[model samples]
Target: MTSRVLIAVTHLLGVGHLARAAALARGLAAAGNEVTLISGGAPAPLVAMDGVRLVQLPPVHIVGTAFSALLGSDGAPAGDTIMEERRRLMMEAVAGLRPDVVITELFPFGRRVLADEFLALAGAARALVPRAAILSSVRDVLVVPSKPGRLEEAHARLLALYDGVLVHGDAAVLPLERSWPVAAEIAPLLHYTGYIDDRPVTPAGEGADGAGEIVVSGGGSAASLPLFRAALGAARSVAGHRWRLLVGRGVPEEAFAALAGEAPAHMTVERARADFPALLARAALSVSQAGYNTVIDIVRARVRAVVVPFEAGRETEQRLRAESLAEAGVWPFAVVPEAGLSAQALAQAVTQTLARPLPPGAAIDRDGVAASVALVACFAQARCRRFPALSRALDEVAAGGGSVALWWRDDDAVAPTPALDRLLSLAAKHALPVAIAAIPAHATQALADRLAGEPLASVLVHGLSHANHAPEGEKKAEFGPHRPLAALCKDAAEGLRRAGETFGAPLLPVFVPPWNRVSDDLAAQLAACGFAGLSAAGKATRPDARRARGLAIAHTHIDPIDWHGGGGLLPLAEIDDRAALAVRARAAAGGEIVLGLLTHHLAQDEATWAFCDDLLAFLLDHPAVVRADARRLFREAGEEEAWCAA
Candidate 1:
């Protein structure tokens, strides 16, 4: 089918995102979809290919996911004019060349300004294009949300607007739950298209003699010179092992030009190269920072190495990423806070890393890529199949008449652009009480003012200041009063009080953390602060699902459209739209038919929103279907049958 595809790319800085978009473009073309690569960040040097087309949008640099109304060359802002120009270019580009499928790179998954363009395109596609597939093609792992206040909620709005959220990370290496929020709800819509970089090579075929001993690397740019130097010094300090350092694109030649000649004979430094995966396949060991790209290379290479997490301000992205890999036993790793790192520490980490056994590089759910691809192909073909993926999702959402309280992260930072309308409407549709967390005083108060009359509107304690977690570690043991916990209890309460007093709406008793990874004392802490409830999800690691056991973390579960790495979106194979066909099959088997839907109010994208409307549209596509909200659902829900032991 000749479907017009608008492939959007918004890497903001790194080239990894554009690289993945280039790869996915390969598949969309093979499947005969008319794919256009919409350029957002630094324009990728064109890779010429037929069927795949490129349309450049004026590029804009994002400071930390928020649109920097200015560009930056050395991490410093350009002029505001640069941002305005990019915005104008994007709108003009979308308005002129209408597409059948507007495939966003990271808007809902990460970049959101594109979402504004997407909504406009979605409307045009729905009206004139008719069969346009609104899709989001994403790499695995979103830099874990670091926004302080409403910025979190602003992101979730992006996810609710898309048709399909295409995840490029293979679940074989990582589960979506390890990193993202509302993973279960987003699981069904997720696709693991494999790590979209470096094809695999067998070590048996390639001689190890030709390759070096161990490979150390930092991804593209933004390399931590201190971290890299420390790692190199550590390797050099060790006497015997052979090592090659892959300096990232971010590193300047001036920084390491002398390292090659000055280095201990055992260590060599080279510019960042693409064949690192090939190097990994033959190496005895590896060392690298935990950029998602680097992590994938090491995993795919299946080499055992020590990871030294980057020590930078609020970089929960690489720190948590490395820790997750370590927890999964992929490597023996260590972290160096940028504030206090040394060459000796790195050298010690390298020495120890060499001794550890290579973890069974994360298990790949073999068919996650195929499953994710199939969902996209089905949409590409515009085939309405049964949603077993959707049905199986509902299987876990126990039918209940209990009061279904809902929770989601919000920063009120992205500015209340019209981007939030559909999501708010959905909450309204369900009569769900929406909770915004981690909001700034003025932002939340303004939000309360804007939402004054809405019965569902309310604010909760999120954070005092919505900055990234202090690098020391912010993940509280479940219920612990940690950084955001205490900050939130103090500030969010004040913000709510100020807003409630001014706007006349009652504030809520929930303490919602920015990322929902609250510490152990948070619940008891919140209760002490007079909080009546707590809401968070995708973390099955927390204790007491029942508030009766502890104030419930959440009653109305959040459905995160897992697009980041294998974190939010499920292994696509697990999703079976065929289960919707099972509705027919369920009738035949005399079984109950229940359909489930979940959303992470954070990290929502254009395709996710479209997919939702499509799913509901599909549900409503036919007559004789009823969509019920959980309000008073426990009363109608069947009770668990118990048998007395005789």
Candidate 2:
């Protein structure tokens, strides 16, 4: 379905709001939705998009009581001329184009710069368009207002105007209440979408260019002067390695005046330019202000930094952000507070940062972005389903020693044809029910048709898709630095969803990633996607329900050998021994041990069936041993239901 989206962005105090909106626009556009970025104030150059249209009004600025007339760098004050022109254009565009969705950024909650304009836009959109979905995009953190009641008023305005609020963070991690004191009432309008961003970290190769141990100095050409001077003064004392400083907007004019004279012969200082990540990737160390966006890039690029947090007085956004980042282990390198950006202080911090080894990098859940995309796609499809809520009972048929199921070859397998009687006899005795590993395109619909309404152990849509093997050490398609990985996963998810509709079961969102191998980045990506759980390589940490893939998976450990397997079967003796050890391990753990199963119908033999009997005998003797559905165990354990109710 095509969607017409209008995104309004205002950056009164910082660029976060605008930046996030830009990222959302990219995602929306990539999904083939028409997106228009409406600028109410100056936004960063980084938020530009290809397919999305950029519409700008004559920019306005806030100055004391009401807004002062804004100028286009001419310095002369222009009256209602610009405002009238912009208002006329804006209403005309809204009435004429009539967008399907109007997303206002930060006005109702954070930015009051363009509150009037956005409110006008909203009124115009509703009166003319009638069917537009009104949304407000906000950051995870909201600065606590000095006068306690201001936020409540702002939130009320938001509640009155916007249909929904898209918060780009998890409520479990940083709940709205943490920032806004009155979060309970606001909960109804909130939609916690994981952070949406497209900026790529600089590749490791770029940092190696222009050798001589480098350091970067950047803070909007206005505040960087002191750091530059301090860095220059420090270079005079530090000997050995040559120092090259990439000066940002902060350097004082005089700091560069004596760069040649103040610095040792080997050290070089140059004026700042963009492409900071590239320099950071190569730099030995950096002494910089703690801007949230820059800090993320610094951590991603693996640069050792001495954080001289910009102190906006009692407003400690930068200071708090830097401290929290270090605590999170992002910048393990070091931190130098705002007051300590002086010559000796900066030089000392720089020396320490350079001497110290770079911090162990943050694991990227390559699957995080992909899984999030898939989750959104699922939500979109669910949105379209239009069916009133419905529930179906789960079927269960127990066998001896807990539960056991087996299956023999079906027509899809490349095997000899079996007569009806022989197949029925074997299936009746050995395979209690069906367990099909439904591979998409080649597998799902077939399994659904073959076993429609039949009792089955489980029918799983495996790993989004079966196409395996990836470059850059990623064994799963859902994870990797692959171009547009989100798009790929979303497509695959759509396919799996169709399979679920056909089978009428949960259809297993469990990710049997082609190879049991998954990179940390991939795992994190899946967690953000709202996957119920991921049956991947490691244990998952759960705060509430479950963590999916690697990051979102609730209770990480479980396997029944009932998972995907090759045609090869374990010898009877080996299977017995493996089961024996598994039994002992479960007894030791004292509760229940989950073992993933790998059943292959194509390779069913007497030896395999016999091994199952032996394991059953052992399981029966150990009264503590329990058989569990991996999905069920995960859900029950993740929500901490027993503990929470108490």
Candidate 3:
């Protein structure tokens, strides 16, 4: 089942938040979801975002490391009008998508600057009838807030609005409590999806591992000037190794040009390259900030490295992550604290990292994309009970060494009406098989031609004329008690002949009477007409109808519409309750059974369409469901003597 997801990301300094969120969006979309990503940061030209619908909001960034002043697109403090506009656009996007999951990047734990917008989005999601899952998407480490009561405030808001917190790092490598003090308070809602790095693991070329080249990268943030200055001095001192310094695009052009001008004969300075990961794979030593994306890339490259934790203002996220990696001994990493960092200290740390042998590998869980998708799927399943019920039924049956069959029967379908076309389209969308019970008398060659175009649409013989002979109509029935046996048998035979002529062999030999009502005499007449199955609405469980006179009986247990009430759809809760009972009945059945779903295309409304979409997706999402036709069901029944005997 493909669900709609809305992910919001606000990156103030670096592209790390937006990049990681984009990775998650790609993962979810690759798993067959319709994803909408709302980003409030400046766009990165090099970062490729595919498979998701992107909504770029008005850009904003922090004023230096203050984290308090918000700068607008013109590089001045954003006025109240700009802030209000951003919030309004953000709210409108959420309301329009009406997504199944609302993922906010670094909210509650970080991104406090945009809390008003995020909280408004969350409130809008809650107000939806079928509310979305409000989730907090945070990185491995959090910048411990220095303000008193800030942790409590974040925790309280999380408890009030968020359903879960997806920590995108392996807890075995660095747990949440190592940096965030209130992790324990939200432990119940915490889920670790490993690290979100989807870079390929192509090993460096033959002689690349021993290249003895030094690689230096400052992350994509304006905060890398100090690191670039120190690295330039270190390049002058490091004698043997060839040095390459990459100033990211986030750094100003003037600073980049200054670093380029100061490059020594033994060094190369340029902008960041797309092959940075490739460079790390071959380098003898790597020096970079302890940003989330970079650290993961370094680990994936498997090179000896030194990290300079960016510690401006109250930002301790990078420093904590760097120290955690060193403490775990995962990589041969030499950490140089940004505070009072000097060129001499950086040069020595680079030398020390180069001298140490690389560890075998880290045991951290790096399956973040897949794990996170699975978790969201489970969360969606839990919220939608129909899926879990259907899943449980399939699992229980499979575990008991039984198989399940499913088929759809659309009653009163004679021609290619718009409603019938929509029903067939829905069936086609899910790859489900649907039997159109066509009234043989009304079945035209045009209808048959239209149906022949659809591979999943099959024809079943509805009763002759579809007219009721039930005296003043106690209820509508084509083969009711008031009808004579001889008349009914003759009509049934004529119906069979008409169906054979109209649909030929493509039409299955199944009889579906109008109003799903049939007599024993009509049942007996089926075999003489060469019918293999009799389908109708029956009890909640299988064998709702029995094998009658050598004809297999398959009844539909699910009908979403309330035909008696102006042809409207039933309440979702009522429909789910009925489905749950059927599932429970199937689980308790002693033998394999086929579950039939009944539908009336002409009588459907919008609510019916929505219900059918969700229900069919849920059923098809399960592995044990085998779409069946009347012929296959009869054949399977013949193969299993138990079905015949029962």
Ranking by lDDT: 3, 1, 2
Model 3: residues with Cα > 4 Å off, grouped in runs:
183-185, 206-211, 384-646
Candidates in order have lDDT scores of 0.53, 0.51, 0.79
Q: Judged by lDDT against the true structure, how good is candidate 3?
A: 0.79
- In lDDT terms, which candidate is top? 3
TM-score on alpha carbons, each prediction: 0.55, 0.51, 0.60
Cα lDDT tens digits for candidate 2, 153-196: 68656544555677665454445565566554456567777545
- For model 3, what is the error of residue 187's alpha carbon versus the real structure, in angstroms, after optimal superposition? 1.2
- lDDT of predicted model 1: 0.53
Candidate 1 TM-score to native: 0.55
What's the candidate order when arranged by decreasing TM-score?
A: 3, 1, 2
lDDT (10s digit) by residue, model 3, range 393-483: 6677767777667888888877778898898888877778888899999988888988888888888889888998887848888887777
**lDDT, candidate 1, 167-253, per-residue tens:** 766555455555666444455556556655534554522556426476777665544465567766777687676878777664557
Pairs clashing in candidate 3?
none
What TM value does model 2 have? Answer: 0.51
Best by TM-score: 3
